[model samples]
Target chain A: MSTLKNGIVCSPAIHAPGEREITFSQAIREAVAEEMARDERVFVIGEDVAEAGSVFKVLVGLLDEFGADRVIDSPISEAGIAGIGVGAAITGMRPIVDIMFGDFTTLVMDQMINQAAKTHYMSGGKLTVPMVLRTTLGASRRSAAQHSQSLHALFSHIPGLKVAVPATPYDAKGLMKSAIRDDNPVVIFEDKMLYQQKGPVPEGEYVLPLGQADVKRAGEDITIVATSSMVYTALEAVDKLAEAGISAELVDPRTTTPLDTETLIESARKTSRALVVDEGYQQYGVTGELAAVIADGAFYYLDAPVKRIGAMNVPVPFSPAMEDLTIPSADYVFETAKAMCG
Target chain B: MTETNGTKQNGAELDAEHWLQAYEQMVRIRSFEEAANELYTSARMPGIAHLYIGEEAIAVGMCEVLRQDDYITSTHRGHGHCLAKGAALDRMFAELLGKEAGYCRGKGGSMHIADQETGNLGANGIVGGSAGIATGAGMSIKLRGTDQVAVCFFGDGALGQGLLYESMNMAQLWKLPVIYVCENNQYGEYTHNSKTAAGSMIGRATGFGVHAQGIDGQDIRTVYSTARLVVDRARNGGGPAFLVCNTYRFRGHHVGDIDRPYRTREEEEEWAKRDPLKLLEDWLTKTRQADASVFERIQQDVQTAVDEAVNFALEAPFPEESEVERHVYA
Candidate 1:
């Protein structure tokens, strides 16, 4: 078994051995594979999951490894898929359901919102549903508005759910592991752009606890809180801002709900300024909620008004330049932080 | 596969015990509903109560075929279901009164009454919601290798729900040991069945490959026999069956609809004339089977039982306010 170690960890065979390199897709595949092997109840079900693997090839070779039953290739029915998973989970099965695209979650909103989220409470706590719903969100490939929407904000608004939007390979593996094991229903939003990006991931089984924020970079002039693909954008913008001599602290909230609001609050209290970044639509987006939480939770510490950066209050257009203009970018984060600090 | 002789045992051979049980249940339901109506109109009860006055025989006939441990899923029209499933009158009455001593600690009122020991899953208020849940219960039984059967009680209006179709298909696909009992009370709320339903009820079940039948629900004997055959088949692993009990409601959908003009008096009178309670009574008296003294004794017994239940409920205390957040998580 090829073992790869980073920092202080060691485990079985990884595609990237002895190298501090693992693609985002490889990280996800490793997490699901290890989890399914560890737990008897873990199984994957989604469209094109078996014979063709996943559309993004993140689930490649899983069908051959786990057989057809565990890696189910379901019919193209999102509602039925989600509904069956809800039933299965309530009846003592842990299903890792894939909705292919985050946009298609709208088709199964009733199953997600009504059944999975409320069954435990509505049944007067007679049931405990353990299931992880994985969907790819965000757009950097010009997939257009229909296939490229970031709707995690909608799911985060729900109370009974736990939302995880991982930004890097290490966080992807760790957060996915945490999500799979969490008792509550978890929606793991994986950005499409981050899938092919490479980063250092530990070789062995690890769980990055949900509801904790990671300080990706440490600086005291300004605080930048970003999620999903925007974390990379924030890091890039920080590099350019460093050349321009504007030091900043960057925080990546690996999970949204049960958000690491404490970390963001502490950082805002120290820096006295915050720039919220997200890829969702402008109104009622994650940035708006984070800004509000900061305003209410740590208003006295703020030296300047909290700035928000998100997609335009419109659909994500198809053109490359327009798409960049639409979604919050590192340039946007940098610009907003600069203006706030100035 | 042992076969016994289908011999006739006096007039009782035609199910005298079963009919007697049905009559007892029908009588109990009628008295209970009447008492609830009187109490509700007087504002004695806590919440809106859906009386099962006009739909007595369906629950009685269906429950008669079920063993004490066999499960049944009820709807908002659940008083008859709880009573038929052998739930304690005191607990049920206490539940209706939102008392602490009630079945669900009075949290689940009339629509959500439940008695787990009796295998009466809580009465759901959502249309067709119980179908899949009952199917899940059947799955639970099958997985545990038990002979227990789950009876899903749904209104005719539930037939249009997709979960109904999805559950029916799943039940048939697995040959789940269940009985899908559709209580066709002729109306869904204010709308007539003719206006809402598509095709025949039997057709809907048969289309899903379940053995389907419809019986005159007002007649306890017919309901008992048909239910016995279907329920027995299910118990012995013959898969699920759909039995649509054709019946009617004598009173308005709820207690307050005294002036609704949706249906004619002729229709109501036609159904009321064949009330399951009177049908059993006529059969019993005509055959000189039960005397006026016996009937009076039965009436007194049921009335006393209902009175004791009401008194118990009235004396029962309300649940503590702290219990609200207690059951939200397991």
Candidate 2:
């Protein structure tokens, strides 16, 4: 029950004994359904969200449960729909707008950045856009440059927007609920690769605060600060590092905007060596920011300079062979952490 | 003066009282813009101000038919719409003056004033920016099952923006209670609409299966009568409608653009002869609704109010430095 400076609980007891398991997509659907049931103001609006249940099928049964009024389909107009989400949110409804892929975020940037992100502040807090833009992030599906890109870092850089990058089913459900209930505009970047990944999710209701970081594995040798899909990769590297006699602590910053710098720096200080990992591009990406934070906060305690592992600063290639080389893998993190520890 | 009954003349079915109110609102918008122009030209007001001088009738006419709870999204040249939508004169001037008592506490300045109580979503700085917001408000109204409609006020320049077409398409498809008011003010910033927009404005909306109409923006009666029909249609679940108001911008784009080389002086002189205020006043007099004395009194009252509002803004304090970090998140 420990809380940080912003009153963010370090770790909530989300998992109960023998909790039911669900896929990441199922958790997302459950979260949206529960929210719509809890508040009549909450509804889903996006292309293919109604009958198609979204292109990724993450929202499979929402239409039948919520009906067409709440689970509405929209034209393939990203800016228009995102703007509708903002206008509706400010007026009275909590709209959950789904962008099919992370790359499509380019089409809605003006609405998200200019209208949604700046409304509250520009209106002097007289108005609030309580909306959530749910989109997918992550590469490696061989969807190529336009379809395959992790653009969470671009949104996190904006001041008013709260960016969430949940790494597990438990975090996804909990974070989605919190985002629906939040009064500020929030963007949730779900890694497409983790949609079908199964994990334990609790039956009872629970909400994870956006700014809190979760320590997946506690260690003392080197700290691995990862986000979204990279959290699992970092965990896999942690197991491999342990076999090599290296105790690596892994941290998942669930939300990037309201970042839990306290937990990240705490872990880095404890381990005295840190390596940041993310699927976003390396240049001006999330890893560079986290590395800078850890480097500054744990500067005196570090054994070596903090290292960063992000997607190679090149367009995601269409070929699987070339795409495989672009994204970071368990071997890359293991090798980087080992080198830092050495 | 040609004698005619007030109700049936000039295509307006409004009573004498409604016509008077519309005239006053148009005059108020003109006075407000004049005051704002004075502030900018005299080096008193900070930042840029887009005068809604010649386009006043469109805003006043459209808003005359709207209820207090109905929503409106405005554009960079939005002072007229905000005033017509019932924004207080003091707060409007205060915002333009960067005062703490402004609608946005001086943060929004002239182009970003938003009043939630008045259902003014905001005056956006970006051209064609509020089309989606207005369409979204309509979607919210539909989802909530409310009878209230949302009006999106933009210049003909916005017709060139893709978001407007996208919003219009969705609005028509979903049958959302939205009224897209395109004030075709002859020019888009410095360029004429002919150079910027290819097709007709009404054609763009009708292409999306939306009910579209174009009317004389200078005549307050025509503007009001058309707006009333469109707003009532949307409110009664008749779906979205596109209203193209053929108007002109009398002044330069902003107060600073004094020499408007983009447009000819002959054209300005031509449109000036059909000033919205002059047209309304002439109609009111000819219909025997109100005499010159009444129009003079209205002008005097508006001038006093504008003077007081300007003084209030001039005397108001700037926001505290600490407020800069506030309101970034709700």
Candidate 3:
């Protein structure tokens, strides 16, 4: 079976028979460790990556394993870090550059969008900028507006970049490994909230392809398309919807760039209704794009208009209550899904 | 590569060989850029073309000191640097014409030209764009344990850019094998460097303690000598050097920009007094490296080369519309 449709093991700890549970952090660590062990050319560079092993601790123990030469700690220069990553990538090194926060992508936009994205095409296919710009994005930790953002849509819009948003531990490790090996520039948006979320990942060498979507729950009433941390929220909403006699299918798009429109279209066609959910701003975001694609692909099969449920249009505030108000909750998802089903 | 006597100041006693190479490179740039200007004026090439008219000496000086394997990242006004770093004439011309045979396969024109084989990272359209790249190349060299030094060429306008400061700091901290060559060509688009910049360009480097120095970029010998010391130091694991070469742009910021609104004719005339070509020609004649006939011969050769490039570009095929989508991914 294709890795995209891998059987979702419910409750990572309550694994079936011989399965093992792993967090999103452990999966990513294993992926990096495996890739580093496999290829001597691969290395990680970012702020606090060496001694600290990154602020999120996703790269813990890597410095000891790979040594400082491979796991470099960069200064707080987003543009420089990005440019250095590009330069090293085109020359020889397979660099996985962590930008710390997705909000800082604005600071390094010239290098990421202008230099890294355009290098391969600008060089007449004579050079390949094979690298991954990894960043953690979300508003759960109350990082406020500056530190939290879901700007994968901005990167996905760029022609030369491949955007990957892995919402599960299984997909995170597999997709990261795949991104590292791929010969084009890839941007991996890791949700900060899902780092501790547990799931079963294969022990041996495994890789998941980009631009693939996974169906968590199969239902006939309505298909709920969710991204990143919102996937779990959709699963929660699915459970709630089922209690109310509304069978809602949960579709998690692993990679949002080469968006898995086919699977979504098929699901929308079958269910005859769709609800797109994301943590990004609803005005111009992944939900908006996916909703359009779903409509274009299966417009006639639709029982009602496509609904886009996302964060309220406001910067993620500091207070827990205010932040909670801004973020989409399970109740919100249930209400949207219920309305669609009704 | 014969060395001049240490006794001669600024290599004034240079031989005919060095004179012709320097003279030829400068002539090549002057001729090529003149052709590009005419092409833009005639509407043959339709894009913003930043010509490197008066900044030939800096590119030639830096490239001469660098080996073919060494890397150099350039700015938008980078045709001179590409030619100096051994970019193919026909390919560059083809790129400017948006033909299939171009350096960017016509995907990138004048502002975005890159020669990978020759180690020209790219001519970035963004100001101060090459700093991080050059530093990264230095990191690669250090990791690979190679003696290859990376040189980044940008204008004086880039001196105010934040990336330059960050890159210089990193280069100093790690002692990366990189050379930061700032060709301060007086203007960053329309504003004068003095009007926009607060302090000296050399201080930008010295503050980081990166062995900074300033020079008259019109004098090719001084430019070459300073670059040689810096490049040699980096190759031998000395560290990064931030050398500021003060040059002037005889042309406007771009092909079509008439600088009458921002700059003055008198000021242009004043700076033209120390034109790099004249300085080199005067030195060559005084040193008896070449007579009038030899100068004419070298100019003729460069003219012929430029003419050949134009013809090749004119005859080259434009990229197919279907192929436009190609290379966007890889």
Candidate 4:
């Protein structure tokens, strides 16, 4: 029910300590609300950000809190909305633009790639695009191929963009705050399935710096690096592995670009085994990139070729059973880590 | 009776100072393009450049009505727009030469030059790319509660692009301080406008409830006069408006197109006769506002400036090889 301001909890501190449980969506909403309140230059513009509060409700309270002038409900024009963000950012404003779905980024490719991403560099650093592009990623809501794809690799591959894939409430809140304040174009990928997922978020000012990886649970047998919703699956696998005395460690890379390969390499060197879990397609995805990093950086330390677990290399299906079969499940991570340990 | 008076024109007369200033701006744009062409042909300036030949009046006229802080989104053919909006020719020439001193610091050659200080958001390579940006900028100005307005400059070729309509709708609905200018230069790359557009370009913006107008883009005074009214309406909280300037490009789509297969030499020469520069000069001389001596003096100034720009770009250094990854982010 409370919003943040300048990274501090604007809520009455009547609750216990400076920490409480919050959902992933609330964490993200708090970041936007807080940043908007703090900086007059910051504003949110997208489809249904004002009236509908976003399809996923991640921007629920922004409209009333900031009023219509700050929280703009744009028409269903992805390219237009994105181009506006690029334009606005360069000309003395920090805009938080939301594309309803990650797949819709194709419509904004020119705006993002040619305009937003290149303005800072092309202007010889004279101009800066201080903006954040938030989009929902991952399948499972039966949105099918068009809406369900995890295409972080597409934007992350570009040289100019900073891609953030936050998994938990804490990370969702922390990274979103950092992104809104960033002076360059940053894309924040929020997983649909993680919306209701809960975690302990700080009740005070907090910001997780971009490009750093968090070691969620430490162990000795083997290490598993996960991203976004897959981090939850990796956590579940870790719970199961502990019962069998596997001692599996979990590393959640909050962002893919500006990746924290050093942490993964250090974990690999310590454990002598690793498994990367990602919900994206197995081929040419984040999994391959992580595997390559471990293979090249921790080649001697990795005893088992630095294995990986990703969704099936095909378009996401509609049926619940088929979708479950395609996405990387807890059992998939458990088995992959189990094999690496053996 | 047909005096080219900047100050005394139809109730909204600008000073004589305005006309000469606008004249100098137009002449500089022409000379800059001429110098760039010479350098590009000589292989001194790299990459393909989109010369704003035969269309200098539109940028100069529109820019004349804008303040230094007012924003304008430009198209690929943007050299004239940048100059008219106050971008230095030295930096533009350096950008063309891939020098660190260029507007884009050697990264965005030709199609992507920009100047943030003067509020020229950018010259977009994408067709109709800056429409949304101009709209957003309009939103920013309105939110900040300033009197500055934004201008989105596109060609008649962009009539088919959905981006223009989308941005226009928002600007009108929100009463954003934005003006959409369609330079109906009769060509979108190789295809002519008549071959591609569906209806009147003005109708497209009007469909979204924005005010619209059509003008003879070859006449610099007409452009300035028309833009002044619309720009004021925007800055003063009257929603968005549209201006479809019926213009032409005497040169090809690009430097080497030759425009051979597209049209005949006679058509090119025909448009050349209605050249905007010549029209402005005749208006000034016939009205006794400026004599042959004034024209001679302005020509010498622009020529010398262009030559200096070339030498500056040639002397400037290229960016360091190690900085290839810099500015991708802050």
RMSD of each: 5.2, 3.2, 2.6, 4.0
Write down the lDDT of every candidate, Cα atoms only. Answer: 0.79, 0.91, 0.87, 0.86
Rank the models by lDDT, top first.
2, 3, 4, 1
Clashes of each: 0, 0, 0, 4
State the lDDT of candidate 1 residue by residue for A1-342, as single tens digits: 332222112233323445567899999999999998998677887888888889999999998898876887766767656655665565556788899999999976766776667655544455556788999899767888889999999889886778999987888999898888877789999999888888777676678899998877777888888899888788878777777788888888888887998999988888888888888887988999999877777789888988888888878789997887887777777787788878
| lDDT by residue for model 2 (A71-93), tens | 98998999999989999998999
Q: What are the per-residue Cα lDDT tens digits for candidate 4 across A1-342?
A: 233321112223322445688999999999998888889999999998889999898888788898999999988989888988887888789999999899899898888887888888877777888999999889889878889988888888877789999988888999999999998899999999889987678777778889999877777989999999888788889888988789887888899988998999999899989899988888998899998998888888777988888789989888887988889889878987887788
DockQ, prediction 1? 0.26
What is the overall TM-score of model 2 with all chains considered together?
Answer: 0.97
- The digit string of per-residue lDDT tens for model 1 on B17-101 reads 5456567788899998888888789999877777787678788878887888788888888899889999888888888888878
Off by over 4 Å in 4: A1-18, B1-12
Least accurate 10 contiguous residues by lDDT in model 1 chain A = A1-10
Model 4 chain A: which ten-residue window has the lowest total lDDT?
Answer: A6-15
Point out the higher-scoring one by TM-score: 2 or 4: 2
Reference-based TM-score of each model: 0.82, 0.97, 0.96, 0.95
The true-versus-predicted C-alpha distance at residue A6 of model 1, in Å, is 14
Q: CA shift at B30, candidate 1, in angstroms?
A: 4.4
Cα displacement (Å) at residue B221, model 1: 4.6
User: Which tens-of-lDDT digit does each residue in A1-342 have in candidate 3?
Assistant: 121223342434223446687999999989989999998878888899889988999999999999998998988988888888888887888889889899988888888888888888887888788899999778878878888778888888887888888888988998999999988889999999889988877677778888888887788999999998888888889888989999888898888887889999999999999999988887788889999999999999999999998888898888887988877788999998898888
Q: Higher-DockQ candidate among 1 and 4? A: 4
Tens digits of lDDT, candidate 3, B17-100: 876898899999999999999999999996868888888999998898888899999989999999999998889999999999
Considering summed lDDT, which 10 consecutive residues are worst modelled in model 3 chain B? B1-10
- Pairs that collide in candidate 2 are none
